[model samples]
Target chain A: MSQIKPKSIRQVRAQWDGLFWTTMSVFGVFYLALIIAMLVADFRFTNWSDMTSLLSDARVRFSIWLSLISCTIAAILSLWVAIPTGFLLARLGSESMTQRLGQRSPGCRRLFNWARYFIDTLLDIPIVLPPLVVGISLLVLFQTPVGRWFDQRTGDLFASLGYAGIRGITYEIPAVILAQFTVAAAFAIRTMRNTFEQIDDRPERVAITLGASHYQAFSLVALPQAWRGIVAAFTLAWARSLGEFGPILIFAGTARMKTEVLSTTVYLNFQFGNLRGAVSASLILVTLAIIVLVLTRLITLGGSSNKGVIV
Target chain B: MISVQQLLLRQGDFELSQISFEIPSNAYAILMGATGSGKTTLLESICGLRAIAGGKILMDGDEITRTPPAQRQIGYVPQDSSLFPTMKVHRQIAFGMEVRGFSQTERNQRVEELASSLEITAILDRYPRRLSGGERQRVALARALSFRPRLLCLDEPLSALDGDTRNNLTKLLKKIQQSESVTVLHITHNLEEGIQLGTDHFRLEKGQVRAVVGKDQGGKNTA
Candidate 1:
């Protein structure tokens, strides 16, 4: 009787384990199925002819070129600021501010802590805000008196640099880049900050002790180690910039080919009831995103597996 | 000679106060302390990695308390050997020289010399991740000494190695210290290892430093 009871318990335990795994698999596969369904729907809504027609359209071609150029520029600019900002944040945020400040008065230490907290929160504002809210805020900001004055000064500066006819940044091509950068740079900075945090700072300290200056240590030791992170950040920013639509719409406007981008082209086609054209443009973006993902993986894998050469 | 006087350091609630010590030039000095006793902190302060609240650090009668780490001419190897992961062994060894604007020929010559002396010539082109624990320590040692800093600070460099490797490295350390004629301030928790390599010994306990007098010296404090 006892032996029979034990066997029955074993059977029940196995059944429970099976049920648990089945539940987990159902949850996991649900998301995968949804993504696959989306791709299938996109493919079904458009044909090769629609894709060809979209490519042949000059407006679509202009949108494609502008998307590429603006996204690339925004990504470059994001990296330019993100690298240093990320490094500083990683260093400062990782170490105790009290220790770095050293034996200061309580008031001073409190002030420093508040400042650090404020800056960190400020940096995260764009990330947490809704995309449409970001667009609205930027639109409202440019209409302010101070913003208008600054825009005029920058316009004059650009004119002096031989870029005539750029009266202001609002509703212009530069606004597209600016709007994309406003949000895309935030993501790049966050990615890079995480990257730098993951890396040990001991090598840079060792480099300094070995008579390498701060800049030398950063460039030689830290930067080389961070190459994969840099690539990831750039690709992420580029991808985010490519898909940015809300801010560009509100800030730069549609304007046909002047400030139009791939994302806006998709939106415009959909608004005009050109479902096939919209799906085709979305497919183009999906294809580009896949290419970037593959390239990033290849570059990172190449760096990791390369045995003889330094990255 | 390296000297510290009344060094006061505070991190959060932990503090090390009124610490004073000195090691003669070319001596292998070992610092012994329990975990969290601030041995690493003191080493970092001397290396200019940590800010000292109130203290004077002098090397060869010149005060370098305010000097930047690059100008301090100290070579530091942390507990994990903290090698640059992206650089080949040769490049790691040559990094300091390259950054300091040494000619390519000079950098090459120094790297070769350090690699040969450290018995790491076979692994010059390999990245640090491929190295075993002992090899990593040896490479880190080579890199630190490549630029010929006046002082070498090693924080538990052999702690992570196996017993056999640890014994081998202790002998190698002694041999290299003598051959290179560089002053060393090594931190270790192992008493026997400290005695084996150290010409001068100091112990940190409860935030204060005291010279560890050997039996041969009749228990007289030297610093």
Candidate 2:
């Protein structure tokens, strides 16, 4: 056996401090260039004054309001659905249920793995598919018999809820929100499931022995332990919803003071040759997104450092 | 309090065959065995955590081989303490009661008494992560006993402790078992612990019991 010499203190320190800063600086330059391009191509500091004016526009107000409401609904829906999906994936990840199932029937393991891969591929499908394709697909639903039936039933419910008739594409805010959820939820579930996977399963087992049923163990024990990861998933999903362009544009067309979200408003204003109006909306959207991202990053970092259960 | 008759478990390469054992009510039985022995498996079978391919288990004269671990009225302290780190000492001790639907007042009272008795009262608010190894074991014991289980199964409970802590805990455990008269099936590979606390001893060797014909021949048998 050979005795390998250890690195000197200086050598170890150089690897830690020197390589770390160099790697960070390289990525920092890339981020800075991206930000600079956004500023130069869209809005410079000179257009700052126009931001408040754009904020006062009725269409702009509606765009902001629509963005807020739709994203809020999408975020809430994504969290609600993703938590259970993530938890189940994490819990079942280790179980030989598939193995046992596979034994009972040959090709069962292959079928189970194929199904898991198929679902995983579907999740990534939303990520890669163009927003326009999403929008067009959603619009095609309106042309179907099922779509017509849904429209009539929903219109009746809206009427009973004290709203006027929801005729055609003119009243499809909920559809647009759902479209966002379909895409956003995939990313949310993927991230959350990864986080849940990192947690040990022993805690959940202990909870069960302590008298909790399976659901009780999950809700009280596993969920709280994985809360930080779930929060990170939520923030990332919310950001995705905020920046959505394709589905919202196609499914919920750009109508002034109607379906005008921040992204759609920017696009519409740009087409009208209202460069300043476009720039102002773009500027606000960018600013709002930056603020949101920073705030969420802070919250996520805070959550990462948090120990034990919230309760 | 607990009895097993012809319990058999087989999993591919490993097999436990026709294992039978009985512990008198209120007796402390230490399952002494070498590594690869079926000591842990036997305990798991009794608690209904593992299914026996063939056998019958009875708790208080009721056949409970098919019963789930949670419904078995048998509390198990796993080898690693297995405390829920997210829960405070107080909540951890009271969790068994909460699961059984005990009222808040009764649960809290039991928790208080157990904490004081176990000398874990000051650490009630602390998480399991902060506790020492011995403290964790004590909390695990308290949590198990708090439910007033029909039996207590300690699966190498002191194996994770340091030398001094293991010795101290062995004494503490013996005191608790005698006073509470909790039917105990304590598993250990340590000969010293087996002798110190065992009212009855069952030695397992490769899925089979090396039955005690007499004390003179006890230490010589091998599977």
Clashes of each: 0, 0
Over the true interface, candidate 1 deviates by an RMSD, in Å, of: 1.4
Q: How many pairs of residues collide in model 1?
A: 0
- The digit string of per-residue lDDT tens for model 1 on B95-155 reads 8788778999999998888888888899999999999999999999998888898999999
Q: Which stretches of candidate 2 lie over 4 Å from their true place?
A: A1-46, A95-115, A165-171, A302-311, B6-17, B32-45, B50-54, B209-223
Stretch of 10 with least lDDT, candidate 2 chain B: B214-223
Local error of candidate 2 at residue A24 (angstroms): 7.8
Candidate 1 residue spans exceeding 4 A from truth: A1-16, A96-110, A153-167, A302-311, B215-223
Per-residue error for B56 in candidate 1, Å, reads 1.5
Model 2 TM-score on a 0 to 1 scale: 0.85
Query: Pairs clashing in candidate 1?
Result: none
Q: Could you give candidate 2's per-residue lDDT for residues B107-160 as a string of tens digits? A: 999998877777789999999889999999999999989889889999999887
lDDT of 1: 0.87
**Best TM-score among the predictions, by candidate number:** 1
